[model samples]
Target: MGHDKLLVLTDQVAVSLATIWEAIKVVRKEGFEKLDPLIITQASSDCLLFEEPSSTDDIICVCKSFEFPGDKLLANIYGVLKPGGTILVYLASEPPKGQTMQSPLERKLLLSGFLDVQTSESSQSLAIVGKKPSWNIGSSFSIKKSTPVLPKVNFDDDMDLIDEDSLLTEEDLKKPQLPLGDCEVDRTRKACKNCTCGRAEEEEKVLKLGLTVDQLDNPQSACGNCGLGDAFRCSTCPYKGLPTFKLGEKVTLTGSFLAADI
Candidate 1:
């Protein structure tokens, strides 16, 4: 029977070779053909630098023997493997305290684009198995184009199509009448901070009137209609609730008027 091709990769030559030899013996005893193992010592280079891509049938890596990053090593191994080829990584030692090796190994294998990645943990060692996809890397094939079939619409000549314009009345069609002013008052009847509609100036005058006791006692009417009560009083008139009096009469505000609403 022809021998199955296998590639044994390791950084620690003596220990890894011994381990591989023991595994080979086990396989032979299980009624399998002898493995033609090609041993390769891992180099310092980022890649394994195999002469031909997709040439190796199977690869075995002694993970505990690696000195460099496992990702770089796995990426190189993936390129060397033929389509549907499998890789077996043997980790002889457990990971750091409280951490498992299975998750990290599975992640690295998946990131390297290996398919059907699996991890098994034994009492002595952990083994990670991953397979290259059936399709070769860099190979491309055209996707089959599909045409969509749209649902057919049937129009009845007897049925009249409703006019959208006929549904709207003259009131609904007319443009809404918006209040004509540069400054719009909010729901609270208060103007914005930077009022453009002269409310800021009125507020400033009201503030000034409140500050000056003389102005509050002897009020001056700007429109000459302040004595006509609130109906004729200007928007910012201080004596809004005051009774109609002579223009020269001094308006004395009551305790109720002086007290705030809060």
Candidate 2:
């Protein structure tokens, strides 16, 4: 069989050397050519720094009397592991007070993008297993673009089922006729409160033509309907609702017309 490389990570060098020795014996008994087991101390920050990336086929983390590996260490381990490689985290001692070993290690493994994470507990130690994915990092593949299929509709068939005459009632079919009258209360087009319908425009023009003392003394009508009473006055007549008078007669505006409504 082909030789395989293994990584043994631990805080204690004695434990890691023992594990490597056992692994070597097992590999030799199994008739392997060689078992190159590398030991990385957890206390050293650059433990995996000298190792080639994605070179190790398997990793055994011996966590005895030491805290579980953190994210950075786990990431370094993942970087060193070959694609489809497996990692076994063996906790030889119980985690610190009020803390768990398996779950947090599993979460950290998953966060580091390990796959098929699992945990098993024994009387002496807890073992967490995870595998690196078969695909290498930074590898890219094209995703086929898909066009959604829309249901077909026939407008001609749909139009034949609809009855145009049945859609309207007698009231809806009837055209409304505007009432014929000069300022009928019900027929009068009421302006909006903001006077957006141009109704106040005429009033504004009338106010702009300020009634000076001379103009008040000798009132003149542009449309000759200023003193013809409300009935005969134009819609915008300033003298509307006033009594009829001669063309040159002075017209007095009432208090109602002078004072604006609140």
Candidate 3:
């Protein structure tokens, strides 16, 4: 470990800077003259801190105070760790307070090409440690196309017994329908996607409001009335029952609705 270089990935640098400072001191005391670590405080969706393969011997990821996708972060970390290098993730996990993530963290690390995955508990934090196998890292882990293996499910039911009536046909899909009511249903399921009794056009209207509908929706701006972007709303205005006005349409301001109460 002493021969390998060190790197740190964190969003809350203010909270973890002290720990990192001590780590650097330890590295320097161990006679590693090149103690300058690559510190990454931020990353983008399309780009991560490391653009190339693993060059560092160890990478420490501090995620106790922040929320992030575990698998994606592990994938990025695995890509930048040298073969046989170590990765240590420090996170908040207090099971007594009903918060526990050690199991999931260990599973993710193992699936992300890291070997010897283990977890330890401290006062208010959980430490996850894994090592990249010393084997050819490139052949074992292709960071560009790395994907976690999903657990396989075993069912005793017969496949032929499945019902198909609930499924929507091609013609039904071609026809427009209205949106569904406020139901806590997962739309990604086949059963939900096949629903057609509801108005499909209404759903299309709502979806189009947030998406591009021929220059009508702008993602960069917020609504003047609600101050929320279109992505979080179905309408630009919430005053129900009011007659909608179109651009260039005119109405007399002397209407009874605006008459002063005497």
**In lDDT terms, which candidate is top?**
1
On a 0 to 1 TM-score scale, where does candidate 1 land against the true structure?
0.52
Candidate 1 per-residue C-alpha lDDT over 131-197 given as tens digits, one digit per residue, 9 for 90 to 100: 8999976889999999899999999999899999999999998899766543442322444677777
Deviation of model 1 at 55, angstroms? 1.4
lDDT per residue (tens digit) for residues 1-262 in model 2 = 3568877777665664554554343324564336556666744422444579998888877776444465677888889889998887777666677876677678878998999998877665677888999888899889999999999975774466768899999999899987653223232343345755454454444355553322333544566567668877787776766788765456666778778789
Error of 1 at 102 (Å): 2.0
Ranking of all candidate structures by their TM-score, best first: 2, 1, 3
Model 1, residue pairs in steric clash: none
TM-score against truth, every candidate: 0.52, 0.59, 0.43
For model 3, how does the per-residue alpha-carbon lDDT over 1-262 read when each residue is reduced to its tens digit?
A: 3455788766553546566654444324565455567777653222365446877778777664434335677777677777888887766445445656777767777887888887767776667778888876446545697689999998776655646765867887686755664322434322236556443443454354543323222222233222232344445345223454332223234478777899
Best by TM-score: 2
After superposing candidate 3, which stretches have Cα over 4 Å from the reference?
Answer: 1-3, 21-34, 42-47, 65-69, 92-96, 137-262
Better of 1 and 2 by lDDT: 1
Candidate 2 clashing pairs, residues 3+ apart or interchain: none
Each prediction's whole-model lDDT (CA):
0.68, 0.67, 0.58
Clash count per candidate: 0, 0, 8
